[model samples]
Target chain A: MELFAYPFMLRALAGALIIGLAAPALGIYLVQRRLSLIGDGIGHVALTGVGVGLLTNNSPVLTAVVVATIGAVGVELIRERGRTSGDLALALLFYGGIAGGVVLVGLSDDKGNSNLMQYLFGSLITTSPQDIVVIGGLAAAVLAAMLLLRPALFALCNDEEYARVSGLPVRTLNILLAVTTAVTVTIAMRTVGLLLVSALMVVPVAAAQQVTRGFRTTMAAAMLIGLASAGLGVVVSAEADTAPGATTVLMALVAFLGATIGGMIRRNLRRRHNRPPVTTEPPDVVLHG
Target chain B: MSMSVVEVRHLAAGYDGREILRDVSLSVSPGDVVAVLGANGSGKSTLIRTILGLVPLSRGEIELFGTPQPRFRQWARIGYVPQRLGAGSGVPATVGEVVASGRLARRGIFRLPGAADRTAVREALTDVGLLDRINDPVATLSGGQQQRTLIARALAGKPDLLVLDEPNAGVDAASQEAFAAALTRFAGNGGTIVLVLHELGPLRPLIGRTVVVHDGRIAHEGPPPEPAGHHAEPDHDHVHPHADEVKAGICEWAPTEGAKSY
Candidate 1:
């Protein structure tokens, strides 16, 4: 009751809950597509966007969305062309982003490093009302996009080559995933911070996949796990006066371990029941003629 | 209405920039079970990929059901079973769900599956003889069952033409029998098939015509090779010694071009 009493805490909870639903929803596609690390890449580029916003006295969220989107589309293009090897292109952009963010934040000495720290580690204690609206709006967009392209995205993630032959626009669908990933990363950066954002995107999904049998079920379960971890992380951190972002990611990790263990136990039980009792009635051995 | 399901003229296609199908021509008429056979890297796979519009053509034309490749959009009418992609891994897919995806090309992206889609999916599973295991994870099935799942997925779309690439490679005898039975049923319904194969094996009886690709060119095209006692025994070894012929064929292209001619 007291946790939700503070306005800032309420705002933070709203943002976290929205992200809890949105991140893993998009993360399922990324994980299925085998591009789980793309979230990390987009988050890194988003840091530079934050730096630009700080330097220009504008909305960091807006800037981060733009910069990260461009980064994602660029990554998809390079991946499509496959001219250069490795994640060289993404790694370069990532390094450049962190460096640029550090320089710009250092230059903008208005509120000292604490101003940047909030975005870096998340500031559930100071979440403004405007922040809640933007996070909610971004969350709505991501969910709407997922609903609109669910089928095509499922087939694309299931098998890219097969989807192409199925007459789904593979290139456009690819761009859709990239753009959504970027958007998910940008908004999520505010709640879990760019450093631990993927914890919300990927970890819960990993946990859900361990327990669920089919893709759709895994997706739904991941969202529930994500919401629980993120919400609990926010409330617990608020009450305990700790970093919400780190605590949230820790909760997700714990959930993943729990899911993995639960899944293993279930599978072992099934194996035991399915197996016939160790039989000793093997006396009908074939005799050489 | 063109009775031909597929037509390719002087097709040249390969990965990236290099070409694999040097100058291959192929045509398949409705109700024909045509098999494209060749050894590894012989470009039989490339030939089928080119025809399906998966692999880009450097030079040549492809027409499916009377429409040019670029203009064709009735993907629902064409069933495709790609080579050796066992049922999805990591995230599990049910035999039913995988079969349902086949309906996506037909059902479009705007809505969920209706009654017709569900019926099609169920019927496809039954066609593959996996109706009882419709809810089972596809990965739990053996190698052959997985291939049948892929075939059933294609069948769910009620495609008039089926293009299968090495559907039997790595498949077990039982699974192959199931697959053959499914194909037989499909053929009985007047479905045309263009299959790329290493060898006809279980499918030998169903094949009406055989086209062998060597060095990216059509090496032979005629009535299905008299099934060699070992396979029209005359078809593979008797008619064409696979090894010596491949050596001669590769040597013809290898010395002048290079290894992996694309």
Candidate 2:
């Protein structure tokens, strides 16, 4: 109750809730497409955007959104081209992002280095009302696109060739997924930090799939897990005086371990129940050869 | 404006500037079961892929259902099954979910699946004899069952023409029979078919014609290649060496040890 009394805590909770739903929402497709690391890559790119914002004395969130979008699109295009050098190209881009961010911050001012820690590890003190608005608007957009295009995105991620033959706009959808991934990273940066943003995007989905049977159920369960982890992590971190992002990711991992054990037990029980009865007697319907 | 169901003229295409299909011309009329046969790395897969607009063509043109491929927008009229060994990706999906994707082109992107889409998916599953396994995850099914799921996905579209690449490779005998039966029914209903094959198996009887590709050219195109004597045995299970002989429709008919014609 005391936590809700603070306006800053309220904003942090609201942002976390929005991100809890949105991250894994788009994350399902990324995982399905086997591009789970893409979120991480985009997050790294957002760090450079953050640096750009600090250098220009502009809104870091806005600059990160713009710069990360371009970076995401560039990565998508290279992936589409699929040259042998594509792997090397993406590696360079990812490394360049972190290096660029740190160098830019160092050049900006001594204060910028201190500010960088807040972005890198995430700080509850920085949860401004403006950041909440940006997070809400962008997260809402990501959620809407992901839900409305579920069928199309599922088909594409499940079987890309078939999706193409089935007349879905494969290229457009691929690019759109890239852009949304960028948007999600920027929105989640303040809550989970740039370095740990992909954990929220991926860990919940991984946890959900352990016990779930189908894509739809896995996605639904992941969002719920994400929501719980985000809410719980924020409250606990405030009490324990720890970094919220690290705590949130740890919560998701805990859920993953629980789901894995639960699923194993369930499978064992079903196998035992379905096991055929053992008998030493010969079958009555047996025929001599 | 051509009357052919599929028309490819002098198609030169391959991956990465390496030409696999050279001066390949083929035409299919309505209700024709045309098998494109070749050895491993013979570019048979490349040929069909080129027709489907998957591989970029270096030269020539492809027309599907009388319209130029680039101009062809009636994708709902054609169903395609790629050379997939199994179904289901890193994500979990049921047989019903995978097959329902076949209706995407028919219904378009914005609209959700209605009653008609669901019925078509059910009917397609029935045709593959996989109606019971509709709710099961595709990963749980055997390789053959997954192949049937892919077939059912294509059939669910109700396409006028079906294109499959290696539909029987690595599939079990039972699934092959089911696939043949489904193709029979589709053909009986006046659907055109173009499939890539290494060995016809149960589909041998259904293939009206065969096009043999050798080093990226159509070497032979006529009546289906009849298996030589004991080579046609149902359970020999040999890998079938001698790709050249098979391409020429004349097998040495070597009977592996203890194999018989019955």
Candidate 3:
């Protein structure tokens, strides 16, 4: 297909590969911690950031990064303030952010900016070299952070209180994690858009978790699943002339469902094969009621 | 002649605004096994929480190893096993990983585990009789096994003092015996222990002293009485059916006012 012949297509493919790898690495931790929706919440915040940047004639990526970072820190602060659940907090912030972005976009006089829709829903074919570089840098930083903080992340996922008691400086680690999430969400927004970014964040990890038992194995599986989804989604989009972002998310969804069903079937087969003979008497029989 | 490992002088602590423990005082010398006994809601857990620096002390002061409790760095010297191990459902971890986390305070934030840390973890697991099940997921373990894993986690730190809140609650008889034996070994090794317990039947013999807390205060404090063999019923005006063995040469008549029945 000579897909790499075009510079823009090459950049787009490289960007997708880098993001697909980094997102799941970060997403595995977020999903395990039940903060999968934080990506969606912060990505929506990035939309408002893009609108603000566009209105001000500034770089949208920079604005998005700044806004996403602020939004991530705000989310962590809100979580610390009260007993409100993380999902509820994310939902509230997401709605508020989308409303603000919608209002900002509507108020803008730039009616002829047809590319704005691409930013909203993603246009991988039109990805620039700058986007590729930004995504690559972000992916490298995220991978490094994940490698260095694997143990802390494990502690955070398993037992945060234990992490804190162990003198892990849990508050600082949490803030660092949120900052990484912000960067990942902001960069991934270029491929999956704001609303659909969480799908990419959660689906690969969910699918991987269904098949893998260990933490390292699950993370590896998730990264592989994400890369497959991104690559297949790009190819399908090219052949069928569809939106790459939506195609990628749909592919991830399919993988998730397939893995879930496969896991269930495997479990059922194992149960049947390992079944013991039935007992006439109950295992726990008390003399008195 | 060394100072007591932990000393709580007239400490009052609680959650949010309401006070749960009022003017409770206790001290634990090195190698002492002090049991804080009381009915539920009598502030036994609150006392442990206060000592561990989990709860704020509303009144009075606490000294750990002869130092005031405000210092954060010294927290590494103390170990804690909360009541609920494997808290709630969906806790995805193995017993070894959970126990290894106890060394976090000693390891600090940036550094990874060293050879010594792994050795301590292995020893702790062996001490708790969970060495064989190190790789088993904590959620899949029985209640007693989970508790032992928690104890192993605490022991991994090799703390000078171990504070446990209701470690024996809801544990099976076998696990209870194992836990008691572990505590005895810990005490023999010159490690101090402070625990909150309800139903001290299985643990009564191991405990050196019992401190009864009532209405957030220290109601009684003395060495636990020796285990008297099964006693025949004494003809008394008010005979309590549950009175099997008396301890400390003190017979406590059931309180008439605000006394909660077990």
Best by TM-score: 2
Off by over 4 Å in 3: A84-92, A109-116, A272-289, B86-91, B225-262
At residue A101, candidate 1 shows an lDDT of 77
For candidate 1, the TM-score of chain A alone versus the native chain A is 0.91
Residue pairs with backbone overlap in model 1: B226-B232, B227-B231, B227-B232, B228-B231, B228-B232, B228-B233, B229-B233
**TM-scores, one per candidate:** 0.89, 0.91, 0.85
What tens-digit string does per-residue lDDT give for candidate 1 at A104-142?
Answer: 777764447787777677666666788788888878988
Candidate 3 overall lDDT versus native: 0.76
Pairs clashing in candidate 2?
none
| Of candidates 3 and 2, the better by TM-score | 2
Task: Assess candidate 1 and give its TM-score to the true structure.
Answer: 0.89
Candidate 1 all-Cα RMSD: 8.0
Name the candidate that leads on lDDT. 2
- List, residue by residue over B1-262, the lDDT tens digit for candidate 3: 4798888998999877899987988888988888998888999888887887767899999988888887756667778887765333232456777788788777765687889989999888877776766765555455666787889898998888888888877665456666787888888888888899886767777788989988999999999755344443354344455444432111132111111100
| lDDT of model 2, residue B236 | 67
Residue-wise lDDT of candidate 1 within B17-62, one digit each (tens)? 8878899888888899999988899999888888878788899899
* Deviation in Å, model 2, residue A250 alpha carbon: 0.6
Each prediction's DockQ against the real complex: 0.25, 0.30, 0.15
For all candidates in order, the CA lDDT equals 0.80, 0.84, 0.76
Comparing 2 with 3 on DockQ, the higher-scoring candidate is 2
